[model samples]
Target chain A: MADFSTDAARALAGPVWLSDRRAYAAAEFASMPPPDATDEEWRYSAIQEFDLSEFALLSDVRGAEATPSGMGDNVLGDAGAVIRTANGRISSIEVDDELAAAGVYVGPLAASGQGSAQLGAVSADATDYFTVLNDAFAVEPLLIHVPAGVVLRKPIVVTHHLSGNRGAAFPRLVVHVGADAQAEVLDYHTSAQGSLLACPVTELDVASAGRLSYLNVQQLGTETWQFSSHLARAERDASLTASTAAFGGGYARTRSDVRLVGRGANCDLLALYFGDGNQGLDFRTYQDHVAPDTTSNLLYKGVVSDAARSIYTGLIRVRPEARGTNAFQTNRNLKLGDKAWVESVPNLEIENNDVRCSHASAVGPVDTEQQFYLESRGVRSSEAERLIVAGFLEEVLESLPVAAVRETLRHQIDAKLSQHVEHVEHVELDELVENTELGGG
Target chain B: MSTLVIEGLRARVGGQDILKGVDLSMASGEVHAVMGPNGSGKSTLAYVLAGHPNFEVLGGSVRLDDLELLDLPAWERAQAGLFLAMQYPTEVPGVALRDLLRVSVSTSNDASEIEAAMRQEAKRIGFGEKFLERSLNVDLSGGEMKRNETLQLGVLRPRFAIIDEIDSGLDFDALRMVSARVEAATKEHNMGALVITHYSRVFEQLKPDTVHVFYGGRIQQTGGADLAQELEDTGYRRWSNENG
Candidate 1:
């Protein structure tokens, strides 16, 4: 649609950097192009979802207020320091000034008015087009930096809300966990009821012996579209735990790119999505191990209903230098409607023979026997389906590190499911929704 | 008479005929046992009678208290007073037993007071109030889950129950507990019960008034608990051919 990446790049280049590292990173992001489905990495996922051709590069500061969506009274404080961003601009910021006192970096990218040069040094190869697109048209990237060896008891939560029709916004985030430092980042991406498009790219680096746990909550409205790219790096003895819960969006695609470049680094990538109505949810993942003795585990689950569909493709690449890498990947889909479809492909390219890797993918409807048992116990078919689907998604939600985020994810899923199921024609599932064949090779 | 009548019932599963023109009936005060060998369609009969979708009714019909059994969904059939205590009850992970019972009770239009009473009845059947709050059959021991199912059968108190192999995986004590609950559910509650099993030990505990030997997909003989004992000694091997 619009080529604002250039203008966006030029704008980011002038920002202040904590050091030379960020400025160089901004330069790298400026030179990259958005990826499309023609690219090998974007095959299974429809890169067309990112085609914000009919969307506006919303610069206007006009939008409705965003109602806080968390459970009860402000649980966002523990996400270290929390902030709320609405209509692509920062409206509220909560920072633990003490962490700032000890030289900690926690603020919005726009607030700092600094940090391009320092961010530049650590940027990886435009891993995918979305990342490049994000880098090009980036805005308000949440800025978070934990100084060396500081263990914050509370996690920092960031809420970004998208509103408006035919309007698209690019979100950017830069997080650097210092050596021997442990930090948690809670990111909530939301959209209003009107149709809007959001393209976001997040860059995270876990320094040696530093632990990073990143959670993304994407609960957009049925009219919005989403293109989110997440890139993470784990250094020697560094561990990264990341989870993405997708409960909203009309058509959404998420790319989780992880690089285990440090010796003995570990990464756990988890995702859960509930697609109802006509929503098409897609996930593209890459676990690239470039060093020896690295370990990675991935678990992704989805509940598809109405005529919704989802595609999940995960690749684990063990370079020749990356020996003794233990990798595991699994994707399980529970279809609430007979016509709901899920496609999953787990790829393993092992250049090193001393590695162990296994992957599995399964797509099926609720067990008929199980349904009968519950129904005979006097539960109606719809209520029974709800119980089974909730239980199905709970498996992944139960493992989330943060209780607040987990509960929000669960509630969002239930809300979406209830709306979708209301229109689901139980008696005519086969006729109302068509099952789309998924998986390539 | 409180009765569940199966008249000339023919059922099919995956295009294979399982229950071939099977006919039987049970009164409120009587437990009728359908004893059969493996592959004799004993369980299939039970499931079809309970409206399992996998089992298609190819011919004939089933009527419980003059209400057409084939005319309702599984849940409706249940609300109409039918219960099937399965051989292998499916475990629903993360579901609390009490939650499931409460939902079932609510769906049946049972008043809140009656629902609470059902919970008490389930508790009396063996499950402690604490255990009832746990997830329905989630990670439960085989025996514990089975007891929970029996507890459900007791609380539900159907007019017609197709209890298939309810004693298969139980020890002596568990079996007695099960039979006692079934007795209380039927004898005291005036429920017509169909107890399907291969072993007669369940009959010894539940005391069925009539026993039918099912072989080759049909009832070969109908008699009393004495018939169950006689077949227990001579297996259905020879009778299967004669009946066929």
Candidate 2:
């Protein structure tokens, strides 16, 4: 266990321009104690089990030539720009010259200088212990900026690869879509086999009438633990679509907050997660409507098998002044094994009488009728189960804006399903068949 | 030469007996119709033959050719050359009709031969190319669903098929269209079929070789196609009263 000190935080902040922000964040972190299970935000979480002292901050790996390997044919071919990060350090960035000349910037946050205030803004408002730690220790933060009225035809992709033992990697990404600009961004987090801690923060600011589509994929090693926070704000008439697909980590927790701060702003939140083995995946979401006529919709679906567990809690809040707001939240889970478990809670807090808000949640095993239907068509039992699970997740995946990423996610899910078939207790067809006969209409 | 033989078959659902000692046989190149009142256990018999998990076969033997089907699972029975056109097909979200057909057809046929067969079947059933891309049974009309089931029967090309209430919700044209497709495919494959229906309209097109009056969970009488017309005109009153 390594004790994270102010000096250590300063040492981890390699760029001189970012030292002041790091010192402030480090002082804040040192002043406050870590949160425990008693905190409302940490309810149902394994916060008491997480010990920050077990990991050390990742040090500067400047000039290190560790390029991302095996990215090969799977890389996004239609991406206008691709940024690769190795151990919290930017290793390579490729951008189309035409887009770059049109004021589309992709580079390290330290290069943004004073313009990087937005990078710290997200962590400053709701400063958690991990957010403060990430603020103080992030080696090199990535920044994506699109100028006013610029519409990039191709998406921008960022891949973070963490490969170290018992070390903490703090990765930060800040995106700004100027007024009336349209863009798509994808963030992929992957790690090698190791007992590492990953703390990442992302901030997205969509200006008036801007449209931004963002996707985040977490595929850390099974031995790793990850805590991620994503904050997004949309201005008047702006639209924001944010999605997540989580598939890895021993204990992965993500908190997403979307604020529709201006009139007529709209936001869509989507997520699909599958956990196998002894993994635990937790998610918390907040949809805040601050201005009139703002709308938000959230849909999250997951499947857990082989003693894996999942937790989902979401809140939709409509302020008093935010009249005519429409909001919806839904969470669905499928437990593929007898020992697998899931807990889902959806709530609505409305302060206005004119707003329309609804929330729904369900947690159950696979539908027997569906399974029987597939088997009757000559599909093997296991193959039938796989198809049902895949179909369960296809709704969320198909909603994604990127076709390429959707296909990749489907393939990854198929791989996971194939590898863990043994862990799933095959439903005894004979017993089900016998039981089914008694209920025939 | 193959036949689907059901002898002295008795079954129950939810601890209550539904089919009591049903006996029937349909050889290849023959189409049989089973007609009775609403509760005559026509659908129950069809489900039992399809190995429906809910329909328990208490005592009986079912065989297709030389294969004993009563002990096999639903999928194995399907692989053994039996098919069931469900009265009410289940809706499968996110599974496309094309994908479902591909999987079902590949069970007994080669993958290379699937596309052409699927296209031909889809066209034969009046389903356009876009219909094949939609989710299985999702938002489809009653006629479309029945046609889709017939399409499945055509694609799989089973040696024997059980059509349960295939004319229940169809309009006049839809019923004729679906029956024509089923008849064409059955004739093309020389397949044995047991068509369950209350109306004699479908029998008019199928021209079944045998018609059995079913009541009280068993076959009451057997005759030619005239029996279906007789039951349709006179109703199942005679058979129901006799069973009582």
Candidate 3:
């Protein structure tokens, strides 16, 4: 096996030149040390749960094409989508030509080379190590650009395929929504059997008066490892909404940052995760408002079973200039087994007295009364527990952008519930059933 | 005929004995009103029969339609044809009223034509289309909760029901609405009902065929509508011999 250092180095080798942006990023990443548990930002975070040697760069992606691990039609591999990385090469992407002609662009990081020059303008200085490492070693990333006043009816889906060996794969995506434009972008990551490491960084910019919705579904195998970061900026009168779900993973951490710099801008964030059996899922988020009249609302829910563990830390920050800002954050957790654990901290920092801000969090076991009620209805104990857990995750599910994705999410959640507990005969719940009583708008 | 027999039924709450030895019975197509003064065991019998967890059954036997009701759970007992219109309904937030009703009905009956049928039945019960859209009793008016309860009775079509003080906190129009739902469901479904009330106004509207006087935790007397009218006139003071 190649030395871990050399292997990490080989992935960063590009033509050396005077410009040298790629080389410079790699040198800093190699020079930087890993994050320590003592960092207050990393409290309760199991940093040691991550190791470099156990993973290898995912070279073969054939397995992902067989079936992306979702339940139904609302998943990857649809016609309008591309499975390039899952094919083990930077293959061709076939976008609906009409969409491309409408000023919408979707492609890999290298394919985004046309606008690769502008990415530097918003790129961070790499003050930390993990952020810089992703910059140095990523396969062709996804780039989406929507022109002004354009609104696309269909959402763009990006599928990242990673194979075995627990090697880290850097997956990055950059989104630019022009002024007064509306667009929805989705990122889906899947891994084959065996352990693997997938590191991802996504950056989004919503221009003045623009509206953008972003969603990410990470359904890696139980033996896979992952770390992800999302940084977003909203300009004047621009609005953004984002949702995330993690149905599978061995150990994972996702961090998101939202910066509101324009007056009258808004951002809404939601996340839901299902963790089971030796799984540890971590989530960190920040909602920072620097301009006046900015607002953001965040809600996250987690359902944990077996020996699974989860941690959530979210904050709402209002700078002094951000007067009249309103922000709210809440996290709820449901424990299906005693071995299941959750830690949630929803906090706020308001320097502006004119702003209205609130934060709340709760972590508890499945409500005994609710479970018994469903069981008494002949739903069976496991099915009853699943319904109660689903109820706890409904708010997060509500924010999912597509119908197929929502159904797949619910199906995967039900399957996970069954796997975590024995004798869990899956019973379809009536509430999730579609009906006019469910009343279509 | 479906028969409900309660023998020496005793219950307690917070370690205090509420029902000493309450015994009563009713056959199918009959509505029995258990009338008593305030603080009597009228509502306790409703809860005890439905098998609510908090109200402990100290010593009792409750058989619904010849099945041991006390041995089963609350929701299961309902599936076995016993419905309780609770005096105070539990508030379930974020659960839409329509969704709750549909799920409750579907899970109990597993009917294929339920979705369309519920829509048609919802309108006839005087609950407008919007009633299903709202959350289950959350932010609902008193009249709305009672109407929703009756709507459950209509849709679930239980063989036996216990209407617990459906008259309390209701205006004239709301009281008649509750009574009308109970009356309509009983008349249409061959249902046997035990309407528990502290005030005689609900019985006046329901016009129960049988009346049982509950005083000091026991059924002291049983008769026809004359007993309800007599209690309404004498106010249970003449039966003060068993008064606490």
Candidate 4:
């Protein structure tokens, strides 16, 4: 943590409250040791290989010319507001005039005048090593606040782009939906091709009777490492939909915690991830039902090809006060390569006897019957496999809360499949070349 | 007219000899009925012709005109104008029927042509348009699954179609409707059909040009349409292995 020291944290320009908060968080981060694979929370993860010393905080002196373009190209045709950040610093932000008139704010958290009061309101209890690092070093945290009774028909898009070799970006975002308000947000993460680290933390707070839909799409470079945290809380009668579509990263992990604090509150957690090359995609989720009649459902589907791997461990905890709760968790994985791997663990801890809970998980190659069925209809073997894989992931992808980017994500998955085929062809070509040379010799 | 010739076809499944030296040949625009009792290897012959992976072909040669079908994979066999209407159609949960038809149709890039053909066939077979949007054969009733097979046969219009036990799970009305569609498709497309069934009720709607008594994994007798009525009346007792 030498590069992420107290001096570095203090040197970051911000308001007095942000400075004080970062200083305290830097002290906490300094005292805490790096996470080990032996820790229960880090089980089956690549934590042992994670070296914090290899990365330095991104420099603040990067000029506008240094900022690469196309990172914030809004695929969503309809957006109420747009915010673009480069290397964890806000480069530009634009809020629709009508949305602004309705008391919607989308800009730097420190300059929004709300200050640090709601920054850590939902994620304060997070003790994860990467989350604490994000707390200490997040340079330009943004806030999207919607006023009570306001309904945003379009989404709010926030794009974070990381650049420079070995440069780390800690992007922090807080979404606050006021009482009876309805809104949707899309958090896009992309980076240049280099050895980079992204530790992002997002806090979602939905007031009583409010509704919020948040989708996090992480498509970083294959050489980058990412550890993201999403902390969401729903009040009485409020509904929250949190979805993630993760496709890129050398070793990416996301830990999500959703707490239903008020009665009649419910939440749906969905994720769609496809890993290729030597990538490792890991996920941990916790659904906490605190009040009576609260409900939660989680569905996560993933595909691993080449030598890639994935891990999914989720838990549903229903307290005694949460009587009549209904919770369901499902994790399905498809392994396309012989060496690909997956670990799916779904647990339930029920302190109430009146709850209905169920869990399901499956890990295997593409179904032979499905393959034969498609192939029997004139589809080639490779095309049959691609179709089955796409169909296997369509369950979760189609249910994504953000509809505008669903097709783009589907195309991305198809592109990954095509690249897998190309990689195999290249390997075969290399073997052929070697054979030819040996024969000539 | 094209010919589908099967010579000395010997195959096994799970280490058991199911198809032991079967011989049959049919010309395009002709309908052949292979009637057999249970475990007579009628289905095995259909699967072997279509190149199912589980069944090991001990020795056989299937030719669709000049194309050697046995050496090809199932999809290649299909591309060579072979189709199998499975008895128990496999359910694909997330892939829609229209999508499957769109890809399986050879003229794939012409989307409207395929869509129009599928909808017309679906209507002829009494299949609802909504079923096209649903997952392929998922949660469909037995009759609906049969109709779905008939619908695909109508749209794909292969050179040869092996209808395996298509009349088993169908009710009387459904059987009549499905068989009528198959009959219409075979005549309209000049498709050679091997309609395998244990019963002759389905023939009321679909008239076979030639009927062959299949027993011991070989054709014991071949005759005209009256042969099916004779087997229906005699119950295949003379052809039974125990009786023989």
Question: What is candidate 3's lDDT per residue for A96-213, written digit by digit as tens?
Answer: 7778788677775454445565453344722355666666666455678888998877777777777756466777677889999988877777877687777887888899999988
- In candidate 2, residue A105 scores what lDDT? 87
lDDT of model 1, residue B177: 81
Please write out the lDDT profile of model 1 over residues A249-328, one tens digit for every residue. Answer: 88888988888999999999999998887888989888999999999999998888878889999899999999999999
In order, what lDDT does every prediction score? 0.77, 0.85, 0.74, 0.89
Best prediction by lDDT: 4
Model 4 chain B: which ten-residue window has the lowest total lDDT? B235-244
* lDDT digits (tens) for residues A1-441 of candidate 4: 338998789779898888888988899999998888998878999989988899999865364222233333445457888888888988888788999999999999999878478899999865577788888899989999999999999999888888888889899999999999999998988887889999999999999999999999998888899999999999999999999999988899999899999999999999999999899999999999999999899999999999999999999999989998999999999998799989999999999999999999999998988888888888787777888888888988888876887877887898999987777678779999999999999
Q: Which residue runs does candidate 1 get wrong by more than 4 Å?
A: A1-8, A12-34, A48-56, A62-74, A77-80, A96-104, A109-123, A336-339, A425-441, B107-139
DockQ of all models, two decimals each: 0.62, 0.64, 0.31, 0.71
Model 3 regions lying over 4 Å from their true place: A1-19, A74-84, A87-92, A117-128, A368-384, A420-441, B14-16, B36-42, B93-111, B130-135, B168-174, B213-223, B230-244
lDDT of 2 by residue, B1-244 (tens): 7899999999999999999999998899789998877877899998899888888889989999888899998889988888888889888888876777667666566765787877888887787767778787889988888988888888788888899999988998888888988787668889888999888999757889999988999999999988887887899888667766
TM-score against native, each model: 0.88, 0.94, 0.88, 0.94
Q: Which prediction has the highest DockQ against the true structure?
A: 4
Candidate 2: where are CA atoms >4 Å away? Answer: A14-17, A60-75, A422-441, B106-110
Displacement of residue B18 (Cα, Å) in model 2 is 1.8
